[model samples]
Target: MNNQRRTVLKSGSGAALLGMLAAAGIITPGMALADWNKAAFDAKSMADTLKALGAGSPADSKDVQVTGPDIAENGAVVPVGVASSLPNISMVAILIEKNPNALAATFVLPEGTEANVQTRVKMGQTSNIYALVKSDGKFFMATKEIKVTLGGCGG
Candidate 1:
């Protein structure tokens, strides 16, 4: 009985040590770092979302191309593509004006990587889509209006 108790205590101590190591950063965490804040994104207006994402005083960029259908037959899957011709592009953020949440997606563009991204998002109504790019520590932005023929959320 004494031997069994000793073995249990050893096991518990080992588990505690491993947990400590993980917490101290000596061991890798189980999940990847997800630094995204959902609550801030959920209710932000377009301009506020831009500020929250650290894109201060973004200028209009003609080099940033936002390609999407002028009108979407279905609002459920409105395809959008964004590409940038600027150098040192770090990030690309997508925002929809008419959604309850303005910010839809944010992509991290690594250095020496192609500054382009494609994604589909649900739109409740006809709205403007904005592409925000972070280049050389400064922010540049572009916008395109997309019309929805039929409402995806509800007509």
Candidate 2:
């Protein structure tokens, strides 16, 4: 099998094993999941989400970059990218202002690693996307508005 297929199989099997364990109570549901910012992910508003993320007052930064299509053809799956030229970026998060959950994703960067990440997220409607970056123990962010269309057919 190709490397990509092998990796997929390995991950799939791991998830299956974890599911079995959780079902059998050998592992609790929480034990089967990775550590994450639950509060941030569950926050409904931008202010609350940033508070949960420990970025209560993030400064706007030109070094931070948020890249995505101005119009996402499909609201079910919108591609987003976040990067930063600032130094010591220890964390990166993508936030959607109008989504049920403001914070969509977060990545913790190891020391010396570049602050660049990309992911796809669901958008219920048009919203502002923010790329929040933690650099040198300070929080910074950039934002862009993305219009979400219903299948690009104007439903």
Candidate 3:
């Protein structure tokens, strides 16, 4: 109980300070938010998704790696991982080719951070999953097929 009170007090003071800073025009509300790529997330096709993300016709690359089960018995929660060995990786995204929305997830990496992420995405059926990466102002891709025995995404 004492720890919870301390956490609340500490965070409350931090938030108050931020509010003061915002009121003083030291920081704006917009500066505190990350840019949301709504168009890419809402795109229904791979080509459209890529276009929304400012990538067109990405080349195949072995430097990008995708790790997931060859066959997922349960499609509701399929574990997937992506990593890239290429230099200057600024962004990475996961794509499920057969899903209603081809783009599943996207990550924006800051400078010098490791370009690797693990996530779980719903699969309606068996599909080719891709790790699309943007490095040095160019896009590259790696692909793998995942067999889903069950349906997710209302399939």
lDDT leader: 3
Global Cα lDDT for candidate 3: 0.87
How much lDDT does each candidate structure score? 0.82, 0.83, 0.87
TM-score of each: 0.75, 0.75, 0.76
lDDT of 3 at 79: 98
**Candidate 1: segments with Cα more than 4 A from true spot:** 1-34
Instruction: Provide the RMSD of all predictions against the true structure, rounded to 1 decimal.
Output: 8.0, 7.9, 7.3
Q: Model 2, poorest ten-residue lDDT window?
A: 27-36
Clashing residue pairs in all predictions, respectively, total: 0, 0, 0
RMSD of 2: 7.9
TM-score of 1: 0.75
lDDT of 1 by residue, 13-76 (tens): 8667756755765444443322454534855588678777877679999999998999999999
Stretch of 10 with least lDDT, candidate 3: 1-10
lDDT of 3 by residue, 18-116 (tens): 667658755545443224566688799889998998999999999999999999999999999999899999999999999988999998999988989
Q: Comparing candidate 1 with candidate 3, which one achieves the higher lDDT?
A: 3
Candidate 3 segments exceeding 4 Å error: 1-34
